[model samples]
Target chain A: MTALPPKLQDYLDDFSFITTREERADFLIDIADSFQPVPARVASKPYDEAHRVIGCESEAFVWAVERADGRLDYYFDVLNPQGLSAMAMSAILDEACSGAPLEQVANISGDVVFAFFGRDISMGKGRGLTELINAVVYHARQRL
Target chain B: MSDIKSRGYANADKLVSTDWVAAHLNDTGVRIIESNEDPLLYPSGHLPGAVEVDWVKDLNDPLRRDYLDRAGFEALAGRIGISPETTVIFYGDKSNWWATYALWVFELFGHTNAKIMDGGRLKWAEEGRELTREKPDIGPTSYTAPERDDSQVRAFRDGVLAHIEAGGQLVDVRSPGEFSGETLHMPGYPQEGAVRGGHIPGASSVPWSRAANEDGTFKNAAELRAIYLDEIGLNPEEPTIAYCRIGERSSHTWFVLTNLLGFGDVRNYDGSWTEWGNSVGLPIEK
Candidate 1:
């Protein structure tokens, strides 16, 4: 469970139009109770500063979050696609962090979801893109 | 992007790039399905984790021909390891022509999640993406097909004849030579068919090649909208049927009109030229 800010919480309460509304309501109840921001570290310098990096546009950031049971999940977040800000990426993370029960809804492996999100960003379609963003926001508001 | 540019994507973005798919080569959840004709292409080399599905052998109803019946499709999906939950991405060479047809078949049975990889293997290999010879381990999964969406598919001969008689706009996406009965590509085809060895009455020739660039990626929204709206004068609201040789190329246009362009009532005449060109006693025009 993750604790969500009040503003996000209010947004979830008013969210509609997504199928399976009650699941979202249940998801909201769990996360609003308890959640925290996992610490993420971006490299001090861009790829040009890293002698070992060889790609054209390369940068790396890692996220470490402490679970309720004191377990830690560590992952490397790579920013490859241009115009996709770290803030937008974090917004997606915040949705997942807020207690979406992602495993229950689709069990999409985190890496697969991450890659899918990256591809979606590359395409620039607001159809499924915004829906996914709204899904996260809605989940965060209800659960975290 | 302007509305014209945005509108061009109607079928253009219905594809995923090989470079994009290659980046996720190791993803176990992303299953790739190849609906191709040649056995050499299927087993010899394909994108990593791709399962070959033959349209004639795996998809078509052997008893009925061309049309895929519910039972056959159900078994085919199971054989290809497609589940209701699977995000099935399909692709094939030649402008993703066959792949879009596969997408139509899947969507007709309610698998809207099925997306065609644009540019197909041609672009993928051109970009130096990875391909594999070893087949992935196959799994059996049950697929519950929803009722077929008849509104989006049609048989070639029947569709064209009906359109000619009914005055509906039949858009032929074949080459001008094929439409004029000058240079037929497919072997064992009769030469004395299709009204007068040409397109149906009231039909317009919009070659499938016009839909995409040489790289196989689609023309942007403005470009496609110009061709479909300004150039061809197709209204997005009206009923339109697209057809080409063997129903393959037409699926490309079908993908553009319905999926990318957001036209609701577009159907692909699957029997296409094979059925239309060989039919007895139809009006022919060069």
Candidate 2:
């Protein structure tokens, strides 16, 4: 299993310093801005059924690349920014799991996904976020 | 109640044609605003001289779940170069769902100069108008705002109860699944939904999408009048309320009633089903 991405850990550690929910959301949105949408090659294929993240409002997709050293780097893209549960969670997972070992990537927990934003979103959103984490972990386990 | 059809709800000039917006792209008094569910669309490409109004940051209070207060609205409007009387024309994706919602917020703040760009982004793109990648150089302006007036337009739970007791009308704009207590939320938004489902008692099922054609332009006044007045049996003199899961789509219907059909009394229950479905002892109908 892959350990969480060290850089994503760094982002969360640095994010933990932000005391305000509004400011944290602001910073996270900027991070979301930095995320690139899914590339056309993957998006144009028959992946809509296989790669579609369940329980998300927007179409959130994740496609990963396996390096020779057994590390997996994932790509996350979304159509709507207001699909905050999907977009934010996918972006976080992409950053957290990229270039990490497969099993470590599989080990990402619900707590990391839900609490990363520093605010308790609705139960429905929490469920969506969990679905996202599960998708990422499921793909990571499949890579092995 | 005021004659909303004649006056266009909050403003006389609330629905501007694409041609009107195109001709006035460089108009100094006009501030074209783009509000979308996808916040990233504007930075990519949008109508010239249009400003992006992020729903979370601009319309909503940064920390609270509520909307922006007077100072917050002022800051947002000022940053986008809108003055108290500036003609704010809103258009965006999703057939102007967020656009109308944004316009409603402007009205709540008593900005009587707000309007919706007819057909929104879809119509603009369909017409093959020139798109701009260059950001407009309009600098910020000192925009002051009055206290948000919820007197006539916004409907609270008690207010809705009173309206119902007083023989008011309610139009539920959610999908059939939601109206029938089948789905807890809109498709694909499972995370942001209510605890329960179903329609408010005495509310009629009138999905907001019915007001627009395939191209997103609103149906003519006659067609709109037929649905709300004849089919639904709503009279222009009686007060009416429209609601969706979170009030955005209902704002679309509200815009139709007050702006298009000019109903005398119209309100948008923004709290919508999320509130009604969660509250204790509130009656519902499936």
Top lDDT prediction, candidate number: 2
lDDT of 2 by residue, A1-144 (tens): 445667667866877788865466566666665666667764664556777777755666777767788777777776653454466566677777777777677777767754565444544455566777777788788877
Model-by-model lDDT, in order?
A: 0.58, 0.77
Model 2, residue B203: displacement in angstroms? 0.9
Per-residue accuracy of model 2 over B1-286 as CA lDDT, tens digit each: 1222443333446788888899999999999988876544565568998888866667887676678888888888878987887888999977898899999988999997788887888779778897665678879889778888888799998998887877789999988888999888765456346777889989998888998877777777767777888898998888899999888899999998997777878999998998999999888888
In CAPRI terms, model 2 is classed as incorrect
Chain A of candidate 1 compared with the true chain A, TM-score:
0.28
- Cα RMSD over interface residues, candidate 2: 5.6
| lDDT agreement of model 1 with the native | 0.58
Name the regions of candidate 2 deviating beyond 4 angstroms.
A6-50, A61-100, A109-133, A141-144, B1-13, B61-66, B122-137, B143-145, B191-193, B213-215, B222-231
